[model samples]
Target: MKRRNFLQQTAMAGASLFTAGQSAAATPVYQQPADNPFNLNYAMHDGMFRNSAGADIIDQIKFAYDHGFRSIEDNGMMSRTPELQKKIGDTLQKLGMNMGVFVITSDNWHWKTSLTTGKQEWIDKMMTDCKTAVDVAKRCGAKWMTVVPGNFERSLSFEYQTANVIAALRKASAVLEPHGLVMVLEMLSDNPDLFLRHSDQAYMICKAVNSPACKMLFDMYHMQRNEGDIINNIDKSWEEIGYLQIGDNPGRKEPGTGEMNYKNIFKHIHEKGYKGILGMEHGISQKGQEGEQALIKAYRDADNFL
Candidate 1:
């Protein structure tokens, strides 16, 4: 049978069994595990369990929550229809799950001159995007959104570029702060030409912006690839870090599938009293349902450090 049809039939059968006072063993539906077994709030993204949950986004979310995840993040939330966004927000609220960061995106975001040029047009676009983000955040119950300052303008001096980024972010912050939302600056390792490539750089920009809405997203995968001392960098940038993302280095996969020791890192973050969500922003190491199951087991093993 088609996956969606099968899922619908399974749900109906499960409801019938429960209504008939049938024993749990009589139902053939997938059993839910204990909720949130991990000490930290690890946020899973959509498509992470498509093989098991089918194509429906809501079903995928319910699957994640049922399998011991307490948070969810979608990088493309802004592009979703308003109706879908509201449904997502309502569902998350009903499940009592935390909503994590979505990218603060725009058409001009990819241009090298976007933020580093210090152009009014770019800043205007950013401000407009920020205002739009406030609405998106309200619909999805998200407190944090990811911001990338785009590529570097080589013609401009490093100081000038930094100043431009800080100025642009300051404007964006003003738009977000009043609404109790934050734009977390993510330092990526994907492109060397990217202006924000280091933790200290992101921290400096956040400090220069100096607003509650402007903070850093200390992604462990990027930091591990960009700089080896994950724990030390996190400590140094701790004051400015508003969010965290996870992916094992060398493979950019789930915990235990790569070189980085996630257990120790998770333990350290928990010890430091971080109550925020850590986004599971990576690919599954294996394929199909087995891969999804292994991904959960990897997190469970890594989270055992507590």
Candidate 2:
């Protein structure tokens, strides 16, 4: 069947399920199954469905929930005001939705001088960020924050750089461990200067850190670009992976619009018993409300493998 036809049929089926006498205003704008639809806990970020949900971040979150999304992530969450963060937390708690990752950053740190430099000032700045992240996490009910080790130090040897990063992460881990929060290390494929670029590299760092609070973030889009053999590498890095993000290659848009087969990937993760969130960290393939509907349909199709 055509994608649009399938979506139209599903929408009609969902609309038919509404209770008698319930006005359209009383029903969720996005017609979805009464229960959370997807088998896996796939999370959407803020503004993903803005065309349908309007401008409010909280409304966007509630819109995602109405479409059967059980979790949400915000990379710039730390930059939000504390009052807004608490409201987000309260809203998620009330809706029984889970919060995913936010990036860990501080004013003193730069991408170039990150953990790879091994400089005390940089490490100290990271520690300060970790302390602040704890409070942010508490307010927003986030368990994991993305941590990038930053660009490589050209003057430093590979072993020295790795050691420096491990030492820095260990320190940050100590502060986060007590709070039951985790800092997930992400490997970037966008730049050659990036210190961490492979799953094995992140797995090694996580092993060396040897702290529960220090784990790797397996971003499927980056990994697909960095290494083509996705499933095998996932198994190898499974033990240390704390979070996952999703995007498709070639265009970095919704799954079906790209080359990666998300259905099989999701099935593999589900069979492996992963209860963690897989963040939908990509842009829509289409535009406006049509794009939002298409995005949800794409996930629904991919998640129907069960």
Candidate 3:
């Protein structure tokens, strides 16, 4: 069944928010402050507001908009049916919000045929995924696609591995460039075996790809966990970076749940005048409507950096 149909079939699509400690008249779980817009485009994913909006992806988008969110990103969007994809695109267009990165090919998260392997089949898959991404972007008004270079090949020499990744990226870039879509490489902290693990490494790969379509994602949570020099690395790679993903370390939740000073970080990015989307890619720290409301307040608090 299409997600849209499943949503309508079950009332989960329109579940109302109730207070955590007190059950009052059903009220929205989140609402933006009177000041209206925040300084940056913090893109939220489907379940970020699910406690309030239930399982309806469209309702979640509407709830985010009502609370001042102006962008949405779904990493698994490519898997969504085209009709659902178009519905999401139309809804975002009507709200004048941005659509952020969806994964080009993340099936390699479990150590599959990575770019490092220099395998013909893997390279062909990369090209095919990039081509598929263009049509996906066209239907959904997306301008960015997330690309993970996959895990390192244990037997391959590091130099040859780097060369193979650059070659694959160049080919993928050709497919995305004409459509004005960017392929942003993400650095993961979930595993040490991953090929692309640092901001500078991604920056180097982006430079080697040498195309406007190639850029760095600069996910703060992973980088912070992998390497502690967050602000400095961000400054060094500022030019090559295209997007940002935020999560508090220790636990991958919204800001303030961990030790990182997101207020200062937000201030730094805003000071540099970054105009792209910063994806809230983490889970909520608290559960239910109260937790959802807390997540909005967290952004509000962090955005106070300006």
Candidate 4:
């Protein structure tokens, strides 16, 4: 497994959590000063810091950078105009920040003719999207994009479905391999109807696909719900894990709000030398700038492990 080390990514926003009885409309705007970054790269999403940065997207990026966040993820990047994408890329470059995953394809959370069907139409659709993903990657300077192979086809057997997904991924991998891009498969725990809901399943799929461009995106929140042994599961799928995401289970909010011990989890990943972007994939537990500040401090509390 390729391992990279990061400093703790939270803190200094610790003050943002407290607002004694302040209403959402009356909450005071808080400024986040750059503090020491965490050992690992915890990338903030656009809306995560909107309270501190206002409604402007570009301001959100600067606010995140102003704090300690050096990476950002935007799942909606594909929907953005090319001009906006370039502006974001340029801004990130100016700040020397890294780009993280955006979705290439997503399931409608319903039964559809997915890759699992071994349907030519589904495969063709995926191939078309793969080509588009390459162009988006280039424009945004992003290396990782999310790929969800839709829901399971009730008519198909599991083995046959697996084979179809693997075949489709190989074709997609070819499109990404030349450009040094990766498509990290996300395992969702939101629905049982979805295929690829487990970490081991993603690991097996990556192995079968056998391409560096095809890797696992271990989302801690989903995995915590699907499989509880977070550390062991991470170690099990380490090699295929090209990216990571953050969210406490139960509430799907920031760390420490739920049953999952994010402090230990963050420390474990850091000490193990797993170097990758950990996307802040959840919402803030509190409201307003206070919520955002708590989000930052929550990371600080969790990443304290050596």
Q: Which candidate has the top score in TM-score?
A: 3
The candidate maximizing lDDT is: 2
Candidate 1, residues 1-306: lDDT per residue as tens digits? 211232244334323323222232222243446554569999987777666666567987887888788899888788889899999999999998989998887653643557998989888889889999999999989999989888898899999999999989988888999999999998888767888889999998988899999999998998998987999999999999999999887877899988998899999999999999999988777765567778888888899985
Off by over 4 Å in 3: 1-26, 33-35, 106-111
| Clash count, predicted structure 1 | 0
The regions of model 2 sitting more than 4 angstroms off are: 1-30, 107-110
RMSD of every candidate to native, in Å, equals: 7.1, 7.5, 4.9, 6.7
Candidate 3 vs candidate 4: which has greater TM-score? Answer: 3
Candidate 1, run of 10 with poorest lDDT: 19-28
Whole-model Cα lDDT of every candidate shown, in order: 0.82, 0.83, 0.82, 0.79
Task: Give one digit per residue, the lDDT tens place, for model 2 in 99-201.
Answer: 9998887642435657898999888888999999999999999999989888889899999999999999999999999999999998877768889999999
- Model 3, span 1-306: residue lDDT tens: 221232232233224432353323137556764348788999988767766765678988887888889999988888889999999999999988999988888453325647888888888888888888888898899999888888888898888999999998998898889888899998888767788889888888899889999999988988999987899999999989999999899877899999999999999999988999999887777766778889899999999875
Candidate 4 per-residue C-alpha lDDT over 1-306 given as tens digits, one digit per residue, 9 for 90 to 100: 000001011222322442444335233354345666677898987667665666557887887887677899887787789988988999999998889998886333223558888888887878777788788888888999988877888888889889989999999899899999999998987667788889989999999999999999999988988988999999989989999998888977789999998888888998888778999887667766768877778887787787
In candidate 3, how many Å is residue 103 off? Answer: 0.4
Model 1 ranges with Cα > 4 A deviation: 1-32
Which ten residues in a row are the worst by lDDT in model 2? 1-10
Residue 306 lDDT, candidate 3, scale 0-100: 50
